[model samples]
Target: MSDTLEILLTNDDGIDSVGIRAIHDALVEHANANVTVVAPASDQSACGRSISHGGEIGLVDHELGYAVEGTPADCVVAGLAELGPDPDLVVAGCNRGANLGEYVLGRSGTISAAVEAAFFDVPAIATSMYVPVDETPLREIDLSTDDFREARRVTTYLAEYALDAGVFDHAAYLNVNVPTPGKRPAPIEITRPSKRYEMDAEATDGSVTLHDRVWESMDPETIPDPDGTDRRAVAEGRISISPLTAPHSTNHHETLTELAETYHDRVATADD
Candidate 1:
């Protein structure tokens, strides 16, 4: 990678999202980075690494960049394989909502975009901002650029440093969560995903409501994760960076190995 980074940017929250725009602006102004954005034309949150598989996908040209009528992962695939130049790095998000914890790793479209890039042997980073749920009626939350300043700064800093410092040599990608900007810039913490999970389901009148209790435990005082976990750090109003690998890992199991080796014998016995 050259000193001037070639970055392919994407996000779950469409190409027009404020968060993605903030990140694009920051990278251009602060790092002098060359960026090409190809993102979902519409919100694809929680879509994970889903692609359009043989279906037709449309790409629309926009002021910020290309808008892909597909999932976040599809944007990465299109950006890397068809739309733009080969990128030195893939940066996804500055997502509207935080994506933390181990359980969300495979389900979050923001992180899944980064994971998709990693599979192509490219270094990637995924970022998000935590938005607290309000009791008020659901309305379009208008976020000013200030709301994304911290995430932009962190994304710029990481994009420059991680490429220069060879941090990708150790990990496939990074999952970053930043708290809402406060009176001062928050501290950065290197963390792991929290293992805690909370879910509740209820059925009434033949319909069902599923609730994710993880949000309820997001308060710093109530979070169950240890201090060094992403959930804990985010709850404590810190920027959390979790280095992660894209592949699912497996360990050798003696019993499984034995079962495989004796498969023929078992089959013969069954026949008898």
Candidate 2:
């Protein structure tokens, strides 16, 4: 509506996280956008679209923006409905870890925030960086704003130009994944979410342990994701952008329709 871009920025990580701060600064300083942050006060990673239903969500004013005591989805709702200005765009993340597969679409709070915006008919972008798992566990790795430099650049560029480019005309949101900044700048790739699903569950000693084995093989050579997939692009040191729709797409199933038509008749015949 306004000539100046108004952006609602949020993330799965807390308001004080480096990734969120990096993108927030980039949007204001580089993109010259009016950015309002309504992010979780604490890390809410992997909390997909969960909201505080029929409950008052607490909000605290921060120097950057408002810190919400709820999920990423709550942040978007609060921002759009009450907390901040009506945004031209909603941005989530510069997330610490990559959300690259179709399976992750329903689990990532970072992407969920963007999806929440889409439900409100607002264009959105969700950005994340690929953190490689090495000898040290991912939890032990300390990342700074420098780690998100490339993500910040790409996100800012998209925020500034994508609207004019009509990128969101078809897509509800863009899921963007970037590799950790390299000596050379990573190339951009338009990709689809990888369909690879490698979840494993082990049951022992009356306890079940669930594991997503995909993280163990992020090497370009060993990565099982095919070309043109988000995971492959990020694994190969490239930025991956997947344009996505919010609502679940459906196809007419003639077989299911026929089955439904016969359901009552079949049950009566069986009873007889």
Candidate 3:
């Protein structure tokens, strides 16, 4: 158990979402830590950091959390700045679905919540479970403390030790996805985010449709990936942990130096 660390937990799912509850309970039980849950009042999946600057924000009180009327990013900004004193860590998700691959990095509200935390210079982790479709929403999955037993186990282990172990030395955040614990519990491994994507769009009558079909298009029997990629390992019943850094890095590049010099030369010509 962690010794009384302060943790701020939110999720892409609403503040009242079952996934968050499982996470909060797990942290409390496993880490024996002080935790505060401040999350959006409604489902905010895929809604990056968008928040209305002057909109009215309502609070829906819960036994374990406060549901704010805003996006996942709004919840984190609110959680870190005004909810409780700055948390030592920020944890997002235990999401009902997986967030993996390169294209998913930008589109996932679950991971976005953790990205928001990174900008604040806090260590953060995002977690999710991959559910196959041809199914109803996850609330119909008969959720319970038992449902997230392994997700919580992996999350608890990382949350307890990742920081002191410097596991995040090269990454801004960790993205973890646990396989459904059924016949067997899988091995855990460190892996990289897979860079694969496929989106199928269709237009019918006067409406267009967008579908994410990479999971469907995959041939698990053939399994093209060379191992150690998040997608392949998880497909093979392994819990995958990927450490990622915030995008949009700025550094000195010599090619850009010439471009800057050209811009200065243009300014001189204009002045002349």
Candidate 4:
């Protein structure tokens, strides 16, 4: 929250990715923050928290930043543990695609980067842009840094205020998604990830094909997202910021507790 902030910037996309470049530039120009960019050498999209561990990780100078030949999570670990200039905030993404819904929390490399930072006890922000899809696959959309204006804007704004405002006091990190660029800037919304699941698989010939039926729900008219969900906010042309915690929660289950208590008795009876 100082006039000059130390920030670690990263993404699921490769170091050459336009999204990360925009983020780096935005932070430097707008937030006046000292930023270090460490990201994958090649696209590591959807590669959750998987790390390279003992495997050798190569780092090379990239036009945008330092490129790590590893997963997004690996980049974070390296940046925090070995990389110089520890950060006050870790910012990930300006991702080409939206990372929405509770289901995506585990699969999205964008969110995974933030989760890794939180484990290191650093407050982080994960920002992504919603790329609309119709009959064609979302990947077909050719995105450039130019496509990430809104995402960069929102990210810079949050970088400036979120820390001083104590946003991280309640949340470990934030999962932010902005609707595609428009004539005017979209409003921000506080939201939670939607609990929506729709995956279908079929065997075609000798191969099994998996289809994500959730894309069908992206249509604003058909989406089942409720008022305060991230999905709903993005669908309605608003920026969605889902405050999230990194650690998994443990809740007491009566059935599991009973099973544990009875297990010894059952084992003794069986032995007898």
> In candidate 1, which residue pairs get closer than 3 Å at backbone N, Cα or C atoms, i.e. clash?
none
What TM-score does candidate 1 get on C-alpha atoms? 0.96
lDDT of every model, 2 decimals = 0.90, 0.93, 0.83, 0.90
For every model in order, what is the number of clashing pairs?
Answer: 0, 0, 0, 0
Q: TM-scores of the models, in the given order?
A: 0.96, 0.97, 0.89, 0.96
RMSD of 1: 1.4
Candidate 3 has what TM-score? 0.89
RMSD of every candidate to native, in Å, equals 1.4, 1.2, 2.8, 1.4
State the displacement of the C-alpha of residue 252, model 1, in Å, after optimal TM-score superposition: 1.7
* Candidate No. with top lDDT: 2
User: Residue by residue across 62-131, what tens digits does model 3's lDDT show?
Assistant: 7787788888888888889887777878999889878878888888888999999999989899999877
Candidate 1 wrong stretches, greater than 4 Å: 136-139
Could you give candidate 4's per-residue lDDT for residues 126-186 as a string of tens digits? 9999887887776677787878999989999999999989999999999999998898889
Using TM-score as the yardstick, the better of models 2 and 4 is 2
Model 3 misplaced stretches (Cα beyond 4 Å): 135-142, 217-219, 251-272
